[model samples]
Target: MRQDEVEIIEREICYQGFYRLERLRLRHRLFAGGMGPPIVREVIEKGDVAAVLLYDPLRDEVVMIEQFRIGARDDARGPWLLEIVAGLIEAGETPAQVARREALEEAGCTVLDLLPISSFYTSPAKTSQRTHLFLGRVDSANAGGIHGLADEGEDIRVVRLPAAEALLLAQQGKTDSAWPLLALFWFAGQREAVRARWSLAGEAPPASA
Candidate 1:
């Protein structure tokens, strides 16, 4: 296993002749439990991912997308959700490149400058997903419309709202998704700087600090 890289070297797994789905002999290790030899576990490493939750300072709004999510199905949070614009990093794509591409694909806006917010895992124990969240300043006015790649069965509706209103919704738990909620509430605390950042878009007047 390389510390700098995610690659891991698995020794082998000798199952007890148990046949199951995929019938691949069910790989395991020589030892199990607290007192045993150091064995290799199923190591599914993750790659770095970049996502942007855009805020259009000029329109005093944030750019979000509404879509149906299976994970939140049959829940009070609502299966359909307003989430920060995001996508997985494609091959040979940088975080910045993913951010700019998703902005146009999901919201039809061009990112003027991408402001990083945080780098954290969407979940660690469950999956090896790492997310680098960004706050992109874009033109929000006339930005809302239907967007998304149809080939992937993605039916996305763009939503732009006043930053204050989004913050209020986040506080009230009206909006869904963790990244957007975090970004909104974070901006809530840094309203002055966020407002200034939005002002750079110049698509609308600067929001009051």
Candidate 2:
């Protein structure tokens, strides 16, 4: 059935803070071509985010960060999660802008070239959070260090490792999150071609192809 088939009976803000929780009561068409019973659900309203997997062609390295994530507090592996540079899209900023800003703030690197990888919803069933992913070429020579906004209570440790090793770790389930893992798998497939394209002797990397 189409979107119009779903009828929203009620929606309200259940909670509001750093993120929002909205309660929804709705129903939609069933397989039998009849309206289904109304169901109630709550969704987290975290606006879209932009994430970048930093790759340095010159060093064949990947730039990542380890930070404490409250959401992963109960994970068997603990809450300090390994992830790439990422940030929420702020007002009046584009996805690419957010990617660049996050790279500098989280990894202390200036992104030279950026390639669009994909966009995905983090958990459609529970939240309205979508993430735009990108592959960014950077100079990883001095990428490792502690970086984060002091006021945001962020304590991020920058990690630079061989791309192959990072990808292997991602493949081995070292990262418990989806965005970084997805970025690594995408890079693994496009590494050679992208490297060749970026080597064409230009100061700025080409736009997303």
Candidate 3:
């Protein structure tokens, strides 16, 4: 429960590349009392991630992306998965900054405003990756086509679907990514309130040339 309750016996870097893998041997206080036996675990240091679900309340549509994912290569649905805009947090950038930048880079949609949604661990058992999620307001009128940094080997295709259709996709287990599913579910429950709030905040700015 507390940091002091755990004692680190040893930590070693098992692998290092684009991401680092560390093996840790530690002991912690048991719930029943007294210290437990030492445990060894390997964790992938993936850093933190920022993800945003781009929404156009005025048009009742959502902007999503389709990209090939190595992790899902063997799945029946294929490796190309539908996902929201997301990127890892670079050195000095904030989660919100990453969200806005990723929205434009991945979907070509400029985020006019943002509403924080959630912060969560993607998979605690394997990776130390946390994601900061948001609902970003955008004008989806001209949001489309392929985007992403070429050097990064990112070939992403922008997809736009009506809000209802997108939600149905999630309900049917089509939008398989955890981030988008979570964001879409949250948007479904808060859709009306968000629309009202954003409407009162004033019209969204026009898209840049």
Model 2 C-alpha lDDT versus the unseen true structure: 0.90
Clashing pairs in 3: none
Query: How many clashing pairs in candidate 1?
Result: 2
Q: How many clashes (backbone N, Cα, C below 3 Å) per candidate?
A: 2, 0, 0
> Largest TM-score belongs to which candidate?
3
* Candidate 1 segments whose C-alpha is farther than 4 A from its true place: 1-47, 197-209
Q: TM-score of the candidate numbered 1?
A: 0.75
Tens-digit lDDT track of model 2 for 1-209? 79999999999998999999999999999998899999999999989999999998766788999999999999989999999899999989999999999999989999998999999998899998899999999988888889999999989999998888998898888877888999999899998787777664765433332
After best superposition, candidate 1 residue 131: deviation in angstroms?
0.3
In model 3, which regions exceed 4 Å deviation?
200-209
In Å, residue 207's CA in model 2 sits off its true spot by 26
Ranking by lDDT: 3, 2, 1
The clash tally of candidate 3 reads 0
lDDT of 1 at 147: 90
TM-score of model 3 (CA atoms): 0.94
Which residue pairs show backbone clashes in model 1?
Answer: 13-28, 57-198
**For model 3, how does the per-residue alpha-carbon lDDT over 130-186 read when each residue is reduced to its tens digit?**
999999999899989999999999999999998889999999999999999999999
Each prediction's Cα lDDT score? Answer: 0.73, 0.90, 0.92
